[model samples]
Target: MAKTYHHPKHDIHEDAGSMRADTKSRTTKFTSRHMAVYQAAAAFAKPPSRAWRLVWSAVLSIVTIASATVAFADALAVPEYVGSARCADCHKDAYETWNKSHHALAWTAPTAGHVLGDFNQSSFTHKGVTTRFFREGEEFIIETDGPDRELTKYPVAGVAGVAPLQQYLLETEPGRLQSFDVVWDVEERRWYHLYPEQELRGGDAFHWTGPYKNWNGRCAECHATGFEKNYSPVNRTYASSQAEIGVGCESCHGPGEAHIAWADPALSYDAEDWRGLSSVGLTMDFGKNTEADIQQCATCHARREPFLDGNPLPGAPFHDSYRLSTLRPGMYHADGQILEEVYVYGSFLQSKMYAEGVGCINCHEAHSADLKADGNGVCTQCHSSAGNPEFPSLRLAEYDSPAHHFHPAGSSGAQCKSCHMIERTYMGIDGRRDHSFRVPRPDLSVSLRTPNACSDCHSDRSPAWAADAVAQWYPDGRHTQFHFAQVLSPARLNPDNARDDLVDLAIYDGLPGIVRASAIDLLSEIGDPEIAERTSALLTDPDPLVRAAAVRLQRGAQGSVAIQNLLPLLDDPSQSVRIAAAREFLNIRAVRLPSSVSQKLDRARNEWQQSLVAKSDFPEAHIVIAGIALATRQFEAAVAAFEEVVTLDPQHIDAWTMIARIHAALGNRETAIRVLDDAIKANPQDISLSLLRTDMLP
Candidate 1:
């Protein structure tokens, strides 16, 4: 799969748990956790002899999640996670197809064939720092700047990814793996830096050795199957484990224990009819269900904030556990084409293909996870003169022909993906295609400064030239139609002035949920007085994104009005929407509601809290927890949570400041001053901290 790691920033998704694959979730707010982790760990040790070996060849250990769960739901017994190797016994063909694919090799212990990078005293220098990659017996050793800014040798504990680039995993301490940022370009066979332009040092969030790079918090959920990030926030330690160290059959096909027993009756011959089990003993039938299958792939493929931590099983509802990021500024072009590493889900959500029920497996093979065919062949599977019978909504057309592309046959321009799903190189050599699959809109590009596929090939030409060429090719096209970018681009810059325009866009029919949701998000930022009344219609919008965004717009309303507006949504079918509505009611105290509505609110509130706690490793979650505690008059609990934030992230200035203020509010002047002093000591380089301490001193 195409991958990229964007520079970490202060990303606080209203409700998200883990980063998934996109380091976009590994935010600057997590900078302090590096200090905390480094302080806790001792001297680095050489990696053991091939300890990180991939586990799919055999099951290592069994974790019966349904051990206690079976009693309550006997008929629907959740299966034990039998590893991928077990599935091979019966499904030989499927196992063989996947055994050598990228998914199978997504993560592994650095064995002979697994370690691709040259470890024979290779040195790579970036930002005036020379890092050496060398072999220490059977271990891959990297000599680089440690958290204390001294050159230290750390052994590679594991390897992540297998393709354009591979990142080394270092166990900074027991049970804590940090994803070293110095990546190996697999294709080029060279080492490169992710942040080539800047000099990153100790405590920097984007630094290779920072908490943002911690494997337990970030990568394990996507790279491993049945992964559990057993993070202990109190002691600041981890006991992370996974069923398999790579994306296995169980990762996508769901736990195969029941499937295995169903296939081989001897395994559970004396038990109840296993065939009668839901999905014929499999967790889900990905081969048959389009939506569930796509969602299963999206578990690792999408760039979104997670709602719950730990890897949810395959076929779990995507919305129930994730809050998909919209086409937010800086991450996406104004017209909703990919700009950053959003992976696939957000982009796919914008495509008409997704609306038409086109799923991951439609063009890509199920086992290998690669395209069924190359380039135009993939698109031609449906776009040919004879349309695919599976999708009757598609019009019969010869899209692969040169006449349609206006380019000579066999040229890059003539390829179907060349014009629609253009590629953007990220994480050095990793080139990711925009899954949104939008048409070239150089006309919008000319007006909005967004990238267009025409510009991608014709690098020297102006947008106007490309627009004219497109106009000549198809005069009656969407190229000239009014696009949402016309309003959204300017709204991003000046939401205040674009209030009316945003309200209009949010209410507009036939737009993608993200576009409308983004409009509502911008409107909320503008503090539009009439926001609650203006976007009222969107509460019932078919898209959960719209409903959730609409629920957020009711944040500031109080009394019976707030309850009336957000109370109904507490029971929303979408877990994401219910969580959104639950948060809106968190600070609304002393408001009486219908008995049913009150019950829903209580349930939704718990749901929201559990989702936040699921990502307890993230400091942002603690900040949210503190806010909740403060709202409910649990000042001591709020302070304790804020202190937990400091423990995880000592560089979090706002958290330290909040801690001081809370103490001051309780009339503990001496304690407040002491807290400020501690904050100053923790962050001596920050002038703002010095000033805060000075202001607090009598």
Candidate 2:
């Protein structure tokens, strides 16, 4: 990615522009080279650590297992940010509109203007702990339970978001900032716990002071501009930095320094007749760029794990920087509806609008971040009596009329959002609308037990009542096509018998790449070599997600079997896919890939290692790092990495148990007992920790 951002507000137009060149082909040509698969097979002759052995068995359950940065590291110059202040000089109105938005206030140093919470010694209690909020001179103070469960006063160092709820951040430890759980309700003008239902306290991973709530690791990337998580693995501290306090002009519009340089009257010239400065000196041309605006927004909006540790280059392709979460069983309904706070990108992927090349800016105003129009007017902008020219495939009809929606005008049921974009509340008070734009499927809700808009509004009515009412309204299952949910639900529930069906779904062309990739990921649990062999064809798939998913399933096979199937993928064009194949290949000590494929493996393996190094702050990242160390017989390094995992997350049962196991294997019985005793103290309820110590005794 170029150092500059490039979404020019005046330049972007909603048209049928060409998509990214990379998306054009699913396959990249790698020369067909027959290489002998032989290297130091003894490299992994030693049995893997207990945690390492779980790679094939339990990697899918770990969110960050397949995380990788784009292979194109340092390939492009990172643009210099001249700040949003420079942008405001050229475009005052746009800057003003953006400044007033939630994006601009996404993250900020505590100030009277930015701080919305009551600081006049306001108090709120949850789970028998009372937290008092007050001001101490210029600093905001949070008097609450600390990490050690002792009453401590933490000075608020930062603030996140400005409306509905505001979260304050405190530098609880040296170089470590954590978002406080006690949030202030902007409307109600009182304090309330975001996780009011949960009995979270000190030491719980989800607690405000725990790793999950770390501001630098979890929140800063999206909340701030040009953020970098400079986490030092050696000292285990953060030196995190950001260009601006909040999501600003440079975030979407690239860097302003180059754009200002391009504005030079002496340098500005047209290149149509071979004149100078044809490129306009921007990171990318937004005039014909359809996906940049949307994909750029997805950099922050999506529920995804980074390919890199923190933020990858903002203007690059979405897959190059991040691996999007699919419609996983817990995160989404079987029918690809939003079930969790997955943000927008994953839900939008399932929409017909996205398939039809609809951009986020189409419905949303670019600067203000408001809908293009209020309520039904926003939907009418495209779904009017005359359909939008950009999408001729869309039906030309009165979609907002009672004749279509089967509800009276000015009613909640009549609203477009109520049906297609049914909302679910998250963070207790934050209600987010769905982005899938799906037609209400009360019928699926009846069978799959998925929530439908009708049943959501009519609380007293069951899905059967909603389905029956739908039958009366439009008899022939109006606009109801065969949904993938019927197949996916069964596949998720019982994978043993659903292998063939899942294999079919993985290759289903009509469905989105995300859905197909999800089907392929599920094949890992089937434990059938035949099923694994079936998904091998998808290794050459155009969709990187599908190909990566296919590569992951090959982990069950060993030696040349895994090698022959995975060698070419090490040179795959997609960074995420290449890294996935490389990670699996690196783990297979059964056979050594010959020097012929070493170059490809080296490049891919380096990229994979870089991802691990980048996300060293995350406990899951350490799991893979530690596994690799154990595989290579670096016992001390393995111990260090496993220790890092528990240090970040004390309740990690696998890491704690593995630590004791490795120590015992090395004949350090006394050292191992001390470790087990500590583990038992941290996780008293987990019997596995206690059993490890009991089994070790003579």
Candidate 3:
């Protein structure tokens, strides 16, 4: 019989700092790749030390570099820091400020020092069910659902900071994973689960051990340092690993090896050293030289997907590996004012600050997670009382007072962020605000029936009432007239009725590019020839995002004429648009292009070739382009593409399967069999690959 361990469900009070110190110091040695599986467990089980421990460890290791080098070589090991201690050494002011910021304590151990909630025996009710929070000895625990219908007790490993809702953590199995459940009333000193009533009453959608519970799949990458979620979906088990527990020094600074090398005074630092070590030493500068790096941070913080891994480096091309949120039905209102949890990255992308090359670091200090200057001071960096000639309305004295805001001077309502950057809560207690920096569009709220800032505070009032109030206060308010009224009008009726409006909106340059791109989607309901032709033109739009959107709309069109019109976009300058265009034109036969159009396509393809010349090291790009070639029946090109994919990402199962298929199609039976055999060697558990190999043996 398997030994089952039961955890007590109650609050555990202890010294969190000591606990974290122990966890960080305790290191485990393993003999195989399977050793990676126990890394998270080892990290979590030890106690944490002060930030100085990590700094001293790094310093000591550096001092005895020759001896440490032999030890590291023998173990194939890397050093782990508690957090950004080495960075703090150089950046004292920033480090001191960061110690007070939320990011430093984003995740902490459960103790009187870190745990801010009332954990004494208290019961709370929600949705007709009651749950209790109590202390059991020195450990925190929760009584919740097990695998079946049983109510079981589990240990609460951590607390999610001080807020209206504090969350508790539970370790499900040793060397496996930890889970989180909601806790309410951090300040009130009362404990209640986030959805205690619903969960206890059997109506909760997010239960323990659900799809969302597996932290490796859902949240580990973002929360922990150097996390590699080795989840085997078939086994339904996680073998996750990380360099360190919690977000540590290496999380943002790539790997520390090169930085360590450059930091040595004996070594002669060069240009490469400067480029690589730039992320170290700290300042408020985020070092987002390329659009991709800026957007890479945004992808995790923003709502996006991982299209491919290790292809485009962080800050290369966002769309190459991720698909950004567009104006979708549930995610946004028809006017795109962010109805759902779109996250800050996408919303910020649409802001004037982003357009002006003002990145996350311009306002936020990276290590400290605090503003570089106070609210008014930061705003005044660009906007002054003397007035910016480019932006005349940005006068500080005029815009700073209650006369312009129509609120009390020191009131919460008067803060620029409170009114413009309305907060949305995620994971029970984390309140994230939109960074779009848009004005209050009460008129749009009335038209689309979406929530506005005025009505959020004044819940009983209508949007029209709020609009009228704003109009009265600022007699010349621009938001009084809705810019997206026409788009919302047709969206209100039916998708079919708004087909023409949608098609027209796609190409309308006057509107925000995102808004127009969203409008093009409304045409999906209509099965007309004209709508297809209109969407085809968007394939050449100046914005790569718009062009990509057009390619998607065109693919759905299914008409031969539409396919022909989209073929030219296959060689688009933007890799995102080109990838989409290539995928769209896959099934269509090549049509004769006009000499001028052919020349344009050739030029675009040349641009794409130049871009790829340097990025040839990446396999996913080859795989994607190869898939396009395969779809177009260019078998040789497909084979070459698949070969590159397999070479770069040896773990890629799809590339191996395609290689087998391409070989079998060419009547190279032995080679096809060998290809599948190699795939099985890489991933022996892949039943599909095994079956395909067996079926191929003639």
Per-candidate TM vs. native?
0.85, 0.85, 0.64
- Residue 244, model 3, lDDT: 51
Supply the global lDDT for candidate 3. 0.54
Q: Candidate 3 lDDT, tens digit per residue, 1-698?
A: 00111111100111101000011111112112222222222232242333222212211211122222222112322233334666667668866776655555655677667766555765555554344556688866566555454556776665544445555666666434445555656556655555444433221214554433445544555555556555431123456666554454455554455455457677554533223134432211246463544664664565543332112222234555444556665565665566566666767766666666667766777766667787655555555566545454443566667886788887767777767776776545556777877778787777666667787777798889989998898778777454654565566458677676677777787666667766655554455666776667777788777877776565455556665667667555555566445344434446766866655444333223323222233344455446445544556656765665565455567778878988998999899999898888866778999999989987
The numbered model that scores best in lDDT is: 1
- TM-score (C-alpha) between model 2 and the true structure: 0.85
Worst 10 residues of 2 by lDDT: 29-38
List RMSD in Å for every model shown: 8.9, 8.9, 15.4
Candidate 1, residues 1-698, lDDT tens digits: the string is 00122322213563211111111112111222222322222111221212111110000011111221112112334466889998887789999999988999889898877989988999988777789989878888999987778888999899888898999898878898998878988888888887688787766655676767778887788889888787764456799878999999888767777777667857763235432234457655776777777877876787766765577656666776677777788688888998878888878888999888999999988888889998788898898889999899998988878779999999888888889999999877789899989989999988889999999999999999999999999999889688889999999899889988898989886787888888888886643337777777788888888998887676545446667777768778777898888776654566566766666666666456545545677776676766666655666766776776776667778778888988988988789889888888777788987787677778
Task: List candidate 2 stretches off by more than 4 Å.
Answer: 1-77, 266-278, 478-480, 556-562, 587-596, 630-636, 663-672, 691-697
Considering TM-score, where higher is better, how would the candidates rank from best to worst? 2, 1, 3
